[model samples]
Target chain A: MLTVKKASRLFKDGAAGFKNITFTVQKGEIVGILGTSGCGKSTLLRVLSGLDHADSGTIHLNDGSPSGAGVIFQEPRLMPWLSVEDNVLFGFKNPSKYRKQAAHYLSLVGLSEFAGALPRDLSGGMAQRTAIARALASQPSVLLLDEPFSALDAFTKMQLQDLLLDIWQEEKTTMVMVTHDIDEALHVCDRVIVLSGQPGEIAAEFKISQPKPRSRSDLSLATYKEKIFSILEYSNTGLQKYSVR
Target chain B: MKSKLNLIGLGMILPVLLIAIWEAAARLGWIESYLLPAPTVVIESIIEMAQEGTLWAHVSITLYRVGAGFLIGTAAAVFIGAAVGYFKKAEHLLDPILQAFRSIPSLAWVPLFLLWMGIGEPSKVTLIAVGVFFPVYLNIVSGIQGVDRKLIEVGKVYHFNSLQLVRRIILPASLPSFLVGIRSGLGLGWMFVVAAELLGASEGLGYLLVLGQNTSSPELIIASIILFAALGKGTDALLKSIESRSLKWQDNLQNAQ
Candidate 1:
């Protein structure tokens, strides 16, 4: 579980990244932070993963271990020099000890056949899957994904979404994903938090309450989609008004 | 494998044909023998040197100097380059001096090195070291600086400490450029040997070149020149093999494309 209280970050050029952002994620929950471009979603994820600092406020991990966080970037970001298996084992102090766990994670991501393959030799989908496997192999209590599937094609994105759902169900690991896609947020996440405006702040939060393996075309998701769309539209208009004034 | 062999064979045709033409032109007296010695005469000089055991002696000495200087220079460059690259303070302190030195030609260092170290092996080795140092140092620094910041973030996210990050991410990411530096440094290392031996004692292929000039034997000069070419090619081939092997991952991706 993670708790962030009134977190804020400001750029050196005096622009705010995010302001007074407060949220708590429970254990094994899949939460999606939805935002448009420049809404500081990725910045928030970076702060949560401890890759960057917050200028103000605090993030406390109730899990007690700081190493419990594993992050997957928008890009796969695999080490080009390493084999798929080695990449999965990259975070381990002694890789050989966790060799079986790495293999298992690779299989979980459906990339066991590519254990010896280099990152460059993989397709985009395969590379992202390998990245997911790498994150899982570290056995993090919280997996933070920053727009992980946005670069992927729609078909591949759908497959990855399903795979993520499966992994969350099976592994029971908490996940906080930053995404721009409304349907993607509806499709995969147990809860969705929308961020909006300049110097972004959390605008709305919605709990899906839909059962696992929910359909993209399901009538239940359409209303949630419409609500998220209106929130985005209102935020855009608000920004336009502020800029014009 | 077969295609690779065919490509090599195709590459050899021009060189082989040129050698034949030179041999024929020499035999036909198209050029005077003293001015441009016959290919056969060059071969004979090589055989004569080999018989006298001086050929191996010179080769061994030159190889030893190149090997020693190259190893020392490359090791120092990697260390200093990594230091400067990883620390802002190191870069601030050392980069300006290095950049200034980088503009000075390798041969220009020879006179100063000789004056300081004396006209001995130390001077020769130091000249070669200076020649080998800059390329490796500059390339390593640039290579480390150019590594993707995203990859460094991944390292940080994974809880890698500074040393672990450098060892796992920084070094391997910069390896391709570092190898390039090694290849170029070795080339300069060979070139500096001539400058080193030009003023010095009585060993190495460069020494043989001076001996050829003193004795007025065109055959000796040609033979020494040929040996330089052969040795340069041989050592380059060794580094090339290492480069290709270490960069096999990149090659696999290219092949897939």
Candidate 2:
């Protein structure tokens, strides 16, 4: 379990974002933080992953204060210099201990045949998969995803969503994904938090009523998506403040 | 086979035409063997020198100087280039001095070098080394410094070991630049080879030029000039072959996706 309390950030240009944002992700639960393009979604993800310091907030994990947390960014971020297996094995301090596990993860990602291939050889989807594999190799208790699947095509996205569910069910780790796509949020998240525009605050909190491994055809999922969309649409606020740039 | 035959035909056209024209001109007395030796006269002179074992001696001694000087000078330049490129302090410290030295041509050092090193092989080898050194070193340093930082960040996320980062990433990215440097350096080195020989030498093609000058034998001078041209062509071919072989991996890696 991971907790975020009173997270507030103020950028230099008097751009206030994420005001008094507080949330908790229960053990094995996957929560989605949904916002328009520039509601400080990436900043919030960065704060949770310890990549950046929040202005005034506390993020704490249960028991040992978060032994390890793996983060996947918007891009695959694979080193062009390394082979796929070597790249997957990068985080391990002890190569001997992690060798077989790396191979297992390689097969899990369906890249066993390309073990010796370099990152330049992989397609965008494969490269992102390799990045995911690299993160999972750390066996993190809290895994952070910041729009990791946005670049992937629909088919590949579905495949990865399924894989994420499988991995989450098997490992039972806490996950927090920040994304702009409401459909992806409804498809994968256990709960969705809708963030409104500048001086961003949690505008809506929705606990997904649908079951896991959900289909797009599920009525409850559609109900949740429509409900979230109506809330987002009610205010022309997030739209006006969401700058694509 | 068809392409190979086409290449052979392309290769024969210039040499055959030139030889035919030369023979006809000589036969008609339009050109003199004395002032400008015909291809046949030059070939005869080469044969005569070969029979006396002089041509082999001249060529061998010249190769010795070039091989030794190039090996030492290029190696030093590469090491220095890598170091200065990798370290900001060294680059800052050495940049001005290197620039100053670069302004002075290697041939300009000839008179002073004779005074210092006594016109020995050291003086001449030093001349050739200086001529080739700057081009290679400058290119190598630029290549190393020019690698994209974004690509390096990718290496960092993957946790690539430092040596692995340099060997696998840095070097390969910089190779094309380094090869260009070497190509230019080889041509510069060839030009300096004749200059070094002309200064003072007991043997070599350049020494033969001096001998021709002393005896007023334009035939020998033309012969030596041809030999020097041949050596330049041969060395360049060798360097290019090595370049192609070393860079062969790039094609596969770039096209693999």
Candidate 3:
């Protein structure tokens, strides 16, 4: 479980990106944060993952601190110099026991055959899968993804999405995925939060009220996708214009 | 198989062509037999030197100096480079002075070294050590710096402390550079060894070169030059084999799956 109370990230005492933002993501629930390109979606994810700190707010997370939270960037960020297995096992301090776990994750991502392959050899989708594998290898309690699959083709993206849903279901980990794709949000997330405009704050939150393993072709998902797009359109048109320097 | 023969053809053609031209020139008096002896004359001089066993004596002394100077110089370079690359304080303090010193050629230190240490093995070794230093240092520094920042971020995320960062990340990243430096240092060692020997040493290939000048034979000088060139090439080949083996992981990571 995670709770954010008035979370505002002000970089350099200038304009705050996220302002008075308050929301709670239930344990084992995948929440998608949808927003415009310049909105604080990635920044929010970074803050949650402890890569960047919240300027002011109480971010209450499970266990000790947010430092242990696993993070996957937009890029695969796998070390090009290491093999696929080695890259997967990078976070594992105990390679003897955890090396098998790396292999397991490699198989989990259907990359068991390419365990010897380097990052450069991987396709965009495959490399992102490896990045996902690397994140899961840490056995994270809370996984934060920052537009992690924006680079993939539609087919590979769907496959990875299914893989992620399977992992999330099995592990029951708290997942916060930031994405611009509304269909993706409706497909995987238990709740969808829309952040509005530049220097964004949470404008609307929607609980899917739908059951697990939701299908995109489902009528409910199609309706939710329309609702999400309209919510974004309304938020953008309604947002107050202010000069940001 | 056909391409292999072409490699062989290219190799055989150049030397055979050079030797034939050299033999012709000596016979035609286009080049003096004494000043620039034919290849055969140099071979005969090598036979004579072998008969007397004096060739090995000179060769042994040169090898000893080269080995001693190389080891000392390479060790210093690797250590100093790692220190400068890893520590901010060390870099700020040592870099400028090292840079100033590096600007002076290794041979430039010979006069000062000889004045201080005399025309002994110490001065000779000192010259070679200084020569070997900068290439290793610069290569190591650049290699460590060249390590992809993203790779370091992986370490940072894992909470690798400073010591572990150097051991797991910096050292491995800098090793290829360090090895290249050592190989090039060995090359520089030959220059210092022979130059020092030419100036003062009683034995060695360079001593033979100077001796030929005294006797005005040129054949013994040519033989010494060939011996030195062959030694340099052989050592380089040996280092290349070691480099290729040691960096196999990197090669696989880069080229293959």
True contacts kept of each: 0.77, 0.10, 0.16
Q: Who wins the lDDT comparison?
A: 1
Q: Tens-digit lDDT track for model 3 on B34-71?
A: 77988888999998998999989988889888988888
For residues B23-141, what per-residue lDDT tens digits would candidate 1 score against the true structure? 99989999888788888899998998899998999999999889889988998999999999999999999999999988987788777887898987888888888889999998999
lDDT of 3: 0.83
TM-score of each: 0.97, 0.75, 0.87
Worst 10 residues of 1 chain A by lDDT: A9-18
Instruction: For candidate 1, report its TM-score.
Output: 0.97
What lDDT does each candidate get?
0.90, 0.80, 0.83
Clashes (N, CA, C under 3 Å) per candidate: 0, 0, 0
TM-score of chain B taken alone, candidate 1:
0.95
User: Evaluated with DockQ, which candidate comes out highest?
Assistant: 1
Can you rank all candidates by DockQ, best first?
A: 1, 3, 2
| Model 2 chain B lDDT-worst window of ten | B248-257
> For candidate 1, lDDT tens digit of each residue in A1-245?
88999999867453558889999999989999998898888889999989889999999887744467989988999999999999999888888798899889999999999999999889999999999999988778899999999999999999999999989888988999999999998998999999997778999999999987898889989999999999999999988898899
Q: TM-score of chain A, model 3?
A: 0.91
**Where is model 2 more than 4 Å wrong at Cα?**
A1-103, A115-122, A130-146, A152-178, A190-211, A223-245, B1-12, B47-51, B158-164, B213-234, B249-257
Which CAPRI quality tier does the interface of model 2 achieve? acceptable
